[model samples]
Target: MKAMRLEAIGKLFVREVEKPVPGSEDLLVRVEACGICGTDRHLLHGEFPSTPPVTLGHEFCGIVEVVGEAVKGFKPGMRITGDPNISCGLCPQCQAGRVNLCANLKAIGISRDGGFADYVIVPQKQAFDIPLTLPPEHGAFCEPLACCLHCIDMARIKAGSSVIVLGGGVIGLLTVQLARLAGATTVILSTRQESKRRLAEELGATASFDPSEDDPIGGLAGLKGLLPGGADVVIECAGVRETVMQAPKLAKSGGTVVILGVLAQGEKVEIEPFDILFRELRLIGSFINPHTHRRAADLVASGKINVEKLISRKITLDEAPETIRNPARAGEIKVLVMAGT
Candidate 1:
């Protein structure tokens, strides 16, 4: 087996290693495809929760090369994707069904070996079986879409409401489509990249803006002459402090703001208390996927979310290191690691 491990901060190594053996409660997946995520970048730079000298690929899917004795309903050739957050199920938060807030939780790639190798092992509890006929690459999207689905679930989006998604990355694009399906009458995407903005428009955003080129908030006001009534819901997916602060400003009175982006540790932003006191806005912080991983697989299988457009680059495992260093390598949007290909 060839594995890509993060030896330490700012370093990754692809080396030969022995394939793992599946335990009774585990399944050994033959890696087919994996997606390089923002978390991976953060982990590489020591910004996220990952121990040094670990195998560091997470967003992925593969064929079940072997299944443990206790793992049933899955065969040697089953295709699946799931990396359940390992948590104390008996903890207060887990008992309250808020397992994302569990006192002790460790993610698969961040806590242990992940899918950036020829084979990876995971508990059957975290694994969701996908139809073997589904392309492995599509299976790779299941995890990310699952996380986005969790956020969408938190939003409780109303039909015909307006939504402004601030960011045009993979998560932002998914948020746009999900908001549209939730019945948002007008979906707006704010991004500085022309290509991303164009793609958002093509996907479903009624409008797109380049903030680097102009004031997005002001532009909308210019058209409507009334600040466009702000958005009924402002979902900040950019994960930057400035954009997070702007979420409140972009949201209308009595509206909700869902923070979906990951911020750095010790990061802070300023928000006026008067605005919250007078306008009555709801602020929510969304975490990782909990029970929605399977639902994400269903959505992808049903062809509800178009992940194909977001996939801009697909490379093999050997190129993972360079791809990790350069975000735009090969014009990457969602750069995938095709392990077996």
Candidate 2:
């Protein structure tokens, strides 16, 4: 089997490896398609915590080639998407139903071997069944869409409310659709990339802005601006210091701000505590997907979210190492690695 392995910090390579066997409660998934995420780049640079010498793909979906004897409600040839984040059921957070914050959490791609190869071992609990009828690449979106769902849940978007998505990446674009579905009448997206901004508008953003061309905060949040005040909710999906810092400022007083982006570890941004205190704003940091994977799968299967348009490119496993080692190409939305390619 060919696998893209992260040998260490700043080192990633495609190497031939022995095929893996599933555990009693696991399923051996023949990798169909796996999306190259920003976290993969972060992992390569040690920006995110990940165990090296492991396969480096988390956003994956595939056909089950072999099912463990202990696994139920699933069979060989069934299509599935792996949740990746494995939480210890006995952890305090898990007991409290906050599984994403589990004290003992091991993600498949980050810790164990993952789906960047011919086969990946997925525990039964971490696998969600999706329709075999959908395109193989659609399944790979479940993980990221699940994370965006969590952010929407936290945003609590209401009918006729306004939302500002602070990035035009896949997360931001998916979020724009979700915000509209959540009943936000006015949805705006801000990104420096003109192409992404245009795509965002097509994907249901009421409007899109290029932050590089104008002052995003003032242009959208000022008294004479789009909202005439500020958005009811501001979700930061750019995962950069500038966007994170601008999130709260873009929100109306007493509104909410959700940070759905993954900033590198040890990164810092200076925010005004006084503004938050005075406005009584709710600032939240949304981590990985919790109980939303199934809903994401359902959304994808139902064809409600436009996963097809978000796919920028599909490459073979041989091309993954170089792709992950470098930054995402300008205006690239999502890149998938096709196992059989």
Candidate 3:
């Protein structure tokens, strides 16, 4: 089996490795497609906490090459995606249905071997059969779409509500569509990528702003007049500190601010205590998903979410390293690493 090993910070290489076997409750999946995430870069730079000598790729899907004993509803040939956030069902957070915050959580790409390889193991409970009707490449998007779904769930956007998405990366674009589906009447997108903004407009955004050239918060006044108060929710999907700090300011008084992006570990952004008190804003943080992955898979499989337009490039496993190294490659947004591409 060929696996891309992250032996240490600032290093990765493809190596021939022994294939893995599954436990009685596990399934061995042959990798088909994996999405390279920004966190992968963070892991490579030691900006995030990850055990060294690990293979890094969590957003992936594949066909079941072999099923361990007692793994039901799955056969050797079944195509599937799964919840990568492995949790101890006995933990307090897990018992409370907040498995994303479980004390004993072990993620596939972070803590164990992930899908950037020929074969990877997953617990049967976390694995879901990909709807056969959809293409395998789209199935690869299941995990990321699920993560965005979890973020949208945190906002609780009301119908006709005003919403803003900070950032136009893969997650930001996905968040725009979900905000529209939640019945938001006004969707404002802030991003520097002109190409991404155009795509966002085609999807559902009422207007797109280039935050690099102009102030995004300047438009909030008009958005406030459009809404009953202002934007009912602001979703910070950009992991940068500037965007994180701007989220609450973009919202109107009493509006909710959902911090959905994964900031680098130990990173901090300054915020005044008086601002929270004066605005009476709700500052909520959305971490990894809880249990919305299946719903996300269904949403994408059913064609309600138009993410195909968000995919800007497709490559094989051999191209993964270069893709990770150069993010500005010709309007790249959600580059799909299809098997044998």
Top candidate by lDDT: 2
lDDT tens digits, residue span 88-203, model 1: 79889999998888888877778788988888998888898888778778888888787788887887788888888998888899899988988888888988888898899899
The top-ranked prediction according to TM-score is 2
Candidate 3 residue lDDT tens string, 1-341: 88877888888877888999999989999988888888888887788878879877888888898888898889988888877888898988889988889899888887788888888898999888876667777877788888888888888888988898998888899999999998898998988889988999999999888877756555444554434355789999989899998888778898899998888889999987798899999999988768888898888888988867877778777777666765556557787777787
Q: Which segments of model 1 are wrong by more than 4 Å? A: 224-227, 329-331
Ranking by lDDT: 2, 1, 3
Candidate numbers sorted by TM-score from highest down: 2, 1, 3
Better of 2 and 3 by lDDT: 2
Q: Which residue pairs come into collision in candidate 1? A: none
RMSD of each: 1.7, 1.3, 1.9
Note the residue pairs that clash in candidate 2.
Answer: none
TM-score of candidate 1 to 2 decimals = 0.95
Q: Candidate 2: what lDDT?
A: 0.92
Model 3, backbone clash pairs (residues 3+ apart or across chains), number: 0
Predict model 1's lDDT versus the native.
Answer: 0.84
